[model samples]
Target: MKKRSFADLFFLLFVVYIVLPVVATMLYAFAGKWNKTILPEGWTLKWLATLFQDTAFIQAFGRSVLLSGGAVIIALLAIVPAIFVIVLYFPKYEKWIQAAVVMVYSFPGVILAVGLIRVYSQFGVPMIVVVLGAYVIGILPYIYQGTRNSLRNVDARQLLDAAQLLGASKMQAFRKVLLPTVYPGLFAGALLSFSVLFGEFVLINLVVGSRFETVQIYLMKKLSTSGHIASAVVFIYIVLMGILTFIIAKLTKQAKGATNV
Candidate 1:
């Protein structure tokens, strides 16, 4: 009884700590005036309305979506197959792949941005391309883990061998048998990657700045203008992330179900 009471108290405190700020921010986004009050003085949607009406915000939102989606697509097309081949045919090289994934996080974003600028700017390469490449590499850990976990959950070797024995070529076996098994996990990873890159600021700011304003860049600009608008941006960002998280959870559950079957 005592332990249960303690657990309840702890859970309440945890919820308050994490949720209070978010709740306050949401209120402020629609609040007419919230100063010195536990409750908002009045509510209005002008902040959100203004945010949507801003062409810059809309463009930045689109750029963020495109950049994140493009990176995930590229990663899925390139990294997934490479990992699949390495896992099935060249198990010994998996260690090298793991090392590379770890290296994704080894360098700070600022350092990476500076190095990319030095190497690519000298050749007159487009800064957008450089940032896109970095975004792809930045998502390696999420994609690699999702793909690796999915592969591990099934007897990939046996499935591939069985498919081959049934007169399927290697490529056919992989495409028809293995890919479907891992699709849910890959999709989840892609969504996760998109969510991460959507909010990325430091690398994009240093590498491209206003040349390619993402949602985060736009949010930074809004902070000095009005607190309400900034709070609206945060609320919208939170909603976007929440939707992606819901999809990821659903996909993960479906993946587990498919693996079990």
Candidate 2:
């Protein structure tokens, strides 16, 4: 009974620790005035309204979506098939793929950005394109893990062999059998990658700067001007992340259900 009481108290403290800041930020975003009080003096939506009316903010949000979506699409198109081939036919090479995924993390964002600028700037290549390419490769670990786990959970080899023995081509078997079975996990990975890239700042800031202002850069620029507006931006960002997390959870549950069947 004493241990149970301690556990409950610990859980309450943990919840407060995690939730207090978010609640405060949300209040500040909508609060007309909040100073030295437990609650705001009054509440208003003026900050959020102001944010929505700003063309620069809208553009930044759009750019973030485009960059993140583009990266995920490129990853899906390239990585999915490569992983399928590796897992299905060339299983011995999977170790090399794992090594490459681990190597992605060896270079910090600053170093990677500097290296990219040195290599790509000399050729006059647009930094946005370079960043896009880097984003695709950066997400390999998520895509690889999600896809590999999905395939492993489903006895992919037997499914593929059965499809092929039934007079289906290897490509056909992959498309009709393997893809449906694994799409939920693939989509969950894509969502996770999108969320990560959407909030990325350091590489994009160093690589392209204001030439391509993403949501994070925009938020950074707004920080000095108004606290309320910054809080509003953060609120919106948190909402987006929450939605993506919910969807990813649903897809993961579905993937597990499919695998179990």
Clashing pairs in 1: none
TM-score of each: 0.95, 0.95
TM-score of 2: 0.95
lDDT of candidate 1 over 1-261, digit per residue (tens):
999999999999999999999999888899997888889989999999999999999999999999999999999999888999899889999999899988998999999999999999989989999999999999999999999989988999999999999999999998999999988988998899999999999999999999999999999999999989999999999999999999999999999999995
Q: Write the per-residue lDDT of candidate 2 for residues 49-114, one digit (tens) a residue.
A: 999999999999999999999999999999888998998889999999999899998989999999
lDDT at residue 48 of model 1 (Cα atoms): 98
Estimate the overall C-alpha local distance difference test score of candidate 2: 0.95
Residue pairs with clashing backbones, model 2: none
Off by over 4 Å in 1: 1-10
